[model samples]
Target: MATVVFVHAHPDDEASQTSGSMARAASEGHRVVLVVATNGDHGDVPDDLADGETVVHRRRAEAAASNAVIGTHHVAWLDYADSGMTGWAQNDHELSFTRADTEEAAQKLAAILREEGADVVVGYDWHGGYGHPDHVKVHAVTKRAAEIAGTRRYLESSMNRSAMIRSHQAAVAAGLDVGDWDPSAPMDDGNPLGSPEEELHWACDVSEFLEVKRSALKAHASQSDARGMLEMPEEWFAQGFSWEHYIEPGRPDGMVTGWFLGEETVG
Candidate 1:
């Protein structure tokens, strides 16, 4: 079976973006490896930490639980500190993933790709979905790593912006209490959320694994970000996350419905 490695910026990212793909890969008997660039030290601090336990430690534990829930065969951490959003002071931290040397980090991830013999590698979109500094760094680092390892199939994990807008409008029309967040609104680095519809290339239907994804999200219960998602009902979660989106750089824009190591068709 071919190996597929997913490179993510922080803990819990797999749950939000690529857990479905990972699950699909494992279910189909392909090896799935997840490499997280940072320990997520900058996420919302939970008040329930045990004495002397740090956020990094808790996040790592959560990641481990998430890995189990998603059936990931293995996981590796780059262990860099989280570089908080666009302008946060943590971005300047010496050990922050965002500030790490690109080549150095790429070399590290390349080693993993080489060791895993990855047939496909997945990273973040150009602006990292919402332009978070660490996420942007992940995109660059993973791209270079794939090049260094000579892996030709590299996909960028992203959201379908037009789909998000449609979902938002549907919620509104149904008198649902939609939050203020808008797909077209300026986010992290002043970029609108997700890649536009025409820019996307693949859509992996993970509706069957919605329960698995939700369980993975719940594994990260300590974080406020995950807590919000956990609060979402199963139907709402399915409505929003049933299909995970991706982009194969330099490929044509038609959306393909398929998994990591399977036949695909333009939809």
Candidate 2:
């Protein structure tokens, strides 16, 4: 069985971006490891909390629930504080993941890759799908980690920009209230979201895993603030999230249309 390690920026990111690929890998008996870069300390605040409970506690529990649902075999954390958004005050925080030394963070992840003998290390795309500060840091750190660990394949979890545009249009036609966010427009970092479809190397179909994906996202209950994705009805959710996209480091074209791994069914 191959070992695939997915390195993500925050607690809920794995659930949204690469959860399907990770779950599919694990279901195929490939060792799947998730390395979360931060505690998500600055994420959406959940209203209902025990007297002293913090978002950290809530998020950790949520992440654990997601880990179980995704069938991930191992989980690790860099324990850095979340770097909020592009220009938030937290961007300059000393403990923020964005402020972390790229090499130093890469060393930590590289150790895990070496320990797990990861055959594939998955990172984020160049602009991190919306250009969040910590996500960009994840891209940087994961790239260096793959190099340091000498991992053979480095697949970047990416969005198919063209596909997303079509999907958004479809959602609108279906009368789904997807909000005013125009994904095609420039993001906080002044770069457009995701890569053009032609630039994507794979579109891993996780439709069958839709239920699992929804369950995993639900695990991050504290993220109720972002209700658009979380509150979507069943059919709408399926329509919007049936496929998870990716890019192979050197390869620039072709779509997988199925699992990231080969179609050999597992027992």
In order, the Cα lDDT scores of the candidates are 0.89, 0.86
TM-score of 2: 0.93
Q: 116-197 in candidate 1: lDDT tens per residue? A: 9888899999999999999999999999999999986999999999998998888889999877878889999999998988
**TM-scores across all candidates?**
0.95, 0.93
In candidate 2, which residue pairs clash? none
Tell me how many clashing residue pairs each candidate has: 0, 0
- Highest-scoring model, lDDT: 1
Question: Which regions of candidate 2 are displaced past 4 Å?
Answer: 170-178, 225-227, 263-267
- Point out the worst 10-residue segment of candidate 2 by lDDT: 258-267
Give me the runs in candidate 1 sitting further than 4 Å from their true place.
263-267
TM for candidate 1 is 0.95
